[model samples]
Target: MAKIKKGDLVQVITGAKQDRGGDRGKQGTVLEVLKDSDRVVVEGVNFVTKHTRVGQSARGSREGGIETVEAPIHISNVALVDPETKKPTRVGHRVEQVEKDGVTKTVRVRYAKKSGKDL
Candidate 1:
């Protein structure tokens, strides 16, 4: 699975729109990660407009309108942001010990390569 996950803050580092004067260096939370496709939906990024036809609700109320929503972007275009440094960084995994109910176990955790802190 990809290291990026929902709620992770990421910055656009490369891609057409992320180049030159686009959303480059802009950071936002990861909304969804499409692991199978190697893509992700980030908040306030890659917006697309969709027009919906008028329809009835379960209660027959009604619903229809145009809306703008985030579109999926290639995962390679973004990099995780370091919490402490507030800069873009790569992700790395490490094993840590945890104890619960008098039992100790190891778990994998993500950390920022730049800040060297748990992400």
Candidate 2:
């Protein structure tokens, strides 16, 4: 499994709209992981319009028309952002020791390659 996970910060790397302009280099956190489909839904990215019909619950809702919602983008298209540098970076894993109750245990952790800091 990839070290990347939900809540990890990421920036888009490729795509027509992504390459063209605004928010292309913007960073956001991963909201959900669609591992079966090899896709991830990033917060505030790949927005699409959705049309909804009037329902009993939303009878008087004026904002029931076409609504734009963020769509899922492929996980491969995004690079994880390093917390230290606050810039996009690739993810790698390493084992680190932590002490608890006078005992040490190795735990997998993420580190920022750019800043050489543990994330």
Overall lDDT per candidate, in order of appearance: 0.85, 0.78
lDDT of 2 by residue, 36-72 (tens): 9989988888888899876656556454589988888
Model 2: which ten-residue window has the lowest total lDDT?
110-119
- CA deviation > 4 Å runs, candidate 1: 16-21, 59-62, 115-119
Q: What are the candidates' C-alpha RMSDs?
A: 3.6, 4.3
Candidate with top TM-score is 1
Clashes of each: 0, 0
lDDT for 58 (candidate 2): 53
Per-prediction TM-score to the true structure, in the order listed: 0.83, 0.77
Model 2: residues with Cα > 4 Å off, grouped in runs? 17-23, 56-63, 115-119
